[model samples]
Target: MQRLYARARRAWDRPLTAYYLVLGGSLLLTALGLVMVFSASQIEALQSGLPSTYFFQKQLVAAALGALLMLAASRMPVKLHRACAYPLLAASVFLLCLVQVPGIGHAVNGNQNWIQLGGPFQLQPSEFAKLGLVLWGADLLARKGEKRLLTQWKHMLVPLVPVAFMLLGLIMLGGDMGTAIILTAILFGLLWLLGAPTRLFATTLAVAATLGFLLIKSSPNRMARLGCLGATDPGPEDQCWQAVHGIYALASGGWFGSGLGASVEKWGQLPEPHTDFIFAVTGEELGLAGTLSVLALFAALGYAGIRVAGRTEDPFVRYAAGGVTTWITAQAVVNIGAVLGLLPIAGVPLPLFSYGGSALLPTMFAIGLLIAFARSDPAARAALDMRQPVFGRMRAGVRRKTMRRRAERPPSGER
Candidate 1:
């Protein structure tokens, strides 16, 4: 055990560790999510008179597109990313505003945060808004830091806080408290990363908490969701139906689970089995072992993101990475906690592991952002440079072997 720990420590100390962890962990979770989505959504799709593969096919296409986006993001220069900050944020804001327009906007499960794009496709602006806030907030702070303006409380909170509140207000207009919570998390994350004074942080937290409580109190649906925490009964009118079923799914999974694709809950007992409650289905089918594996992947991804943030010299990279980390981590905890009955069901999808193109696309791009930052590290860059020749030689050796085998082989026609 000691030897293993030492070996792991050494590996963790390597320059490229963060890069590989971010890449590998994100990919693994995505792949697993695709499998689970297929398994969990088939029943729902068929029941809706669609092909069994409908949801999975859509998710597959989204994953493909997201992969391309991630690759492009990873290859982009830091300057290009910074340049995109304002435009992306602008686009996100525009789309978010569009979602509030009667003819353009669409609601799903009471959240008026979507825009229907012809035929089975929908755009969720809030998802992109999360990304927008991270980039814009980071850039804002980075510039302020460079100007030494962050020392003043007003400079730190002025535009950033106001703009964040604007975005939050827009989101709340759609009645998406779940997303609102995530946006608030990102806001606090940015402030915390900027090393806000304790008093300011406390004040901000208090205000957020108060606003959240008021929001919850104002909406019956939101109130019911909050009241469902740790609830075993389905409540009057089955308000806790989804929550209770989620727990049931996990409870039945035991230690090793019932095996993949065999979840009974997905057969109509559980709601949103492929999206928000996918974790419960995962626990049911893959058991504690599978759930733990998923948790481990998230832990690795979060740890890698932290390493990237801590090791970076660039202020933008540090703030951006920290913000992304906080966003993903907070969302995951809320999602999994809700499934476990430890928290209220927030309607947030598990990051990189749920069936939502809007969520997955931005998240994969964020992973790419981490990858880019990891590569930017001086030591990581040097290590990659050192590895080029070895990889080239290996490729050359494989080519030579293939050529020799081809030359020595009988022609297809002659055989």
Candidate 2:
């Protein structure tokens, strides 16, 4: 346990600035989650004759445990993350495969993507897959960059794209479209940061957009959602009910919100209050002001990730940090967008803010990686070197003493 704690502290101690960024982001999100969960779940529990704070209590435990894991991960170096990437990727893939097995995996809302871990907590393998794929992709790209993929895409990217698609294909089998899209965004972001071929990325983006349209349109349930956007009367239990309720929650909040835990929509009117639609509850109880605050928090996270990526010279560190950062930020955007009715719902949870052990722990661990890379930066070392006043004074004194002795000495012949 001592060893474990030391390792985790290394990530935080690596760079004070990086540590602060992660700390701020983590604390803000956790605090915001606590508030929103309570606001969203209060009415939900009353409607169902359960404890009003049931969801909040569970989320608090998960967040606390997740923080512990994050600290442990932060102590590791980038080399450690790179070395473990492959094994982690393989493990996540295996778990995802297990989730597909009958009787082993549990089905929820038409998608059989969750595995019952024999507890109140269920494991979402795709969440782990997102983290694994990011690290693995980063490792691959770092190797390519080492071999000068900075100038050679044909040899590097051809191999890279397939691995990405393979992971996406496996995830899509669960019909987890939101996770797939988030993974794709991370992949593209990493590739872009690694300087992958521009034409390839743009072309792939176009193709992806087309495929996403086809996927959504193929399902009548999803198609109805798109059609209901313009319809005033979507009926009582139609496609628009969820989205319309979400919108009403936001509008009801007005500016300052209806005070904490006073949301009326969470009274079974809005669906998935503790899951994908958590953002709707935020808007409903905390109002537009609160929703924007959440957005700003994610914006800060993206900034930190970008800064870390830019600070590191190691390709592996850059890609891994950037990939993970992109993954979380992108997921946050998609979740918020879905709640705002700007996008069709695809059942993506709100990263740290959502009540899921799987998403929370892995995400916190990834942030730990970001801090590790940021702390190990070349500039940080230089700054530390400059701060050692004792060493600087010692060297300065030595130079002056030598100059004084030389001045007092006779010519070289006398010496």
Candidate 3:
């Protein structure tokens, strides 16, 4: 057992461990998401007079596209990522602005944050903005130097805070407080990675809390959601309906679950069985084991992301990994928290597990960015290079065999 443990330790210590960890976790989550989405959406799709596989087909297509994007990003050179930072940020800002164009932007569920891009297709700029912020912040800080940002608070806060707020304002204008909160998380996560002063963090936290209170108080729906705290049963018909159903779904599933595609809540009881509340459906259908596995995979992904950041010497890679890690993990926490009734419903989709094309695309790309960072580690690059097949190995083996045969001849005279 000790020998096996030592072997496992050695394997885990490899430079490529971070890369494999991220890949494995992301793929598992994506696959599981497909299964859950299909199961949860079956009844809804059929009720809409569409094929039973309508939502599943759409989700599968999105997943395929996302996988291609992820692969492209993963193979991209780190320098290329840095080079594209400004352009990507600029484009994201333009899209965010364009989303506010009257008649051009589309509204859904009180949030006018999406733009219709032809039939049955909509694009969410806020999702792209998350990626943009991470890249732009990392590039800016990496250029200024991580040490300067750490020592000088002014250097850290200057344009970053203002730009972040501007983005937040744009998102909030569209009534998407959820996306705004996530953007804030990315900004602060980057700041924290740079070792911002504790006082600064505290100040920011207080301000954010105050602002969040104001935002929540301004919306009746948000207030109702906040009121769901410590509720045994949903009060009004439309008040805590989603939250209550989510809990009911979870409670209905014991240890092994009711089996896949057998979730009672997804039939009609639970709203958004495949999106924001998908975790609850997962619990109902696959049980405690499914939910725990999802959490474990996310934890592994987070560890891999942090490991990549820590092992890298490049400031850009470090900051980017840190920001991406925080973005994915924070959003996951919010999504899961809402489903578990621990927090107000934030309408944020679970990373790699939700039924939204817009969310999945950028998230997969971000995971790819993490993979790129892991691959860029010098030791990891060397190890991967050594794995490539080489015809020279065959020639070297032949040369060694000849040399051994000659040596076995017992010298020039003895042969």
Candidate ranking under lDDT, highest first, comes to: 1, 3, 2
Model 2 lDDT, residue 267, Cα: 82
Please give, for residues 1-415, the per-residue lDDT of candidate 1 as tens digits. 9999999999889999999999999999999999999999999999999999999999999999999999999999988888888998999999999999998999998889999998899999999999999999999999999999999999989899899999999999998888999999999999999999999999999999999999989888888888998899998899999999999999999999999899999999999999999999999999999999999999998999999999999999999999999999999999999999998888999998899998999998988999999999999999999999999999999999999999999999999
Q: Write the number of the candidate with greater lDDT, choosing between 1 and 3.
A: 1
Least lDDT summed over 10 consecutive residues: which range in candidate 3?
146-155
Q: What is the C-alpha lDDT of each candidate?
A: 0.94, 0.80, 0.91
What's each prediction's TM-score? 0.97, 0.84, 0.92
lDDT of 3 at 106: 96
- Per-residue lDDT of candidate 3, residues 1-415 (tens digit): 9999999999989989999999999999999999999999999888789898988889899999999999999999988999988888888889889989997899988899999999888999999999999999999999889456446788888788888988888898899988888898998899899888899988987888899899999998889889997566878575888999999999999997899999999988898899999999999999999999999999999999999999899999999999999999999999999999998899999999989999999999999999999988999989888876465688889999999997777766665
Worst 10 residues of 2 by lDDT: 225-234
Residue pairs in collision within model 3: none
lDDT for each residue of candidate 2 in 72-175, tens digit (9 for 90 to 100): 77788677888888998899889888887988888778877899978667888888888888888888877866776557657556766777787777787888
Question: After superposition, which runs of candidate 2 have C-alpha atoms over 4 Å from their true positions?
Answer: 1-18, 46-50, 229-237, 381-415
Deviating ranges (above 4 Å) for candidate 1: 402-415
Candidate 3 to truth, TM: 0.92
lDDT, model 1, position 167: 92
Better of 1 and 3 by TM-score: 1
Candidate 2, overall lDDT?
0.80
